[model samples]
Target: MQTVPMVKQKVHQTLDTLPPQGLKELSQFLDFLKYKYQAERRTNIVALGGIWQDIPFDVTDEEVRALRRRVTDTLLSKV
Candidate 1:
């Protein structure tokens, strides 16, 4: 069985040889895989809608923007 590094190396080698159209297809496939994986792993947000109803919070637009930037950076770092 191939290890994670071996699989990644094989993927990169294949990607390097793909043409523009092949690369586009690969990108779309990867996006689909990410979406499918996330969908399967996600909780049903609607079912938990009222779980946080007791919490009170208020924030300005600047604070929200900064929080979003920080969260995005953190998530991207994991990739």
Candidate 2:
């Protein structure tokens, strides 16, 4: 993949400056963005915020956290 110059810098800057509410809004916006474009997904996994490596769903936070823990445990066992 071709790297977009200044992409990381600008993304970090924007995320860092977001207030809590803005962060929530950004999260929702990202959720929509991912869903809208998912049919065109090329890779097996899609990354977000450089660090996150999965899709964020509309499920409750508790459910999401549980899933994350499961994925972490499974990945750790594999390595």
Over 4-78, each residue of candidate 2 has an lDDT whose tens digit, in order, gives 767877788899889999999989998999997996776665346644545564579999999999999999999
Q: Candidate 2: which stretches are off by over 4 Å?
A: 1-5, 40-79
**Over the stretch 1-79, how does candidate 1's per-residue lDDT look in tens digits?**
9999999999999999999999999999999999999999988744324766666565699999999999999999999
lDDT of 2: 0.82
The regions of model 1 sitting more than 4 angstroms off are 45-79
Pairs of colliding residues, candidate 2: none
Clash pairs, model 1 backbone: none
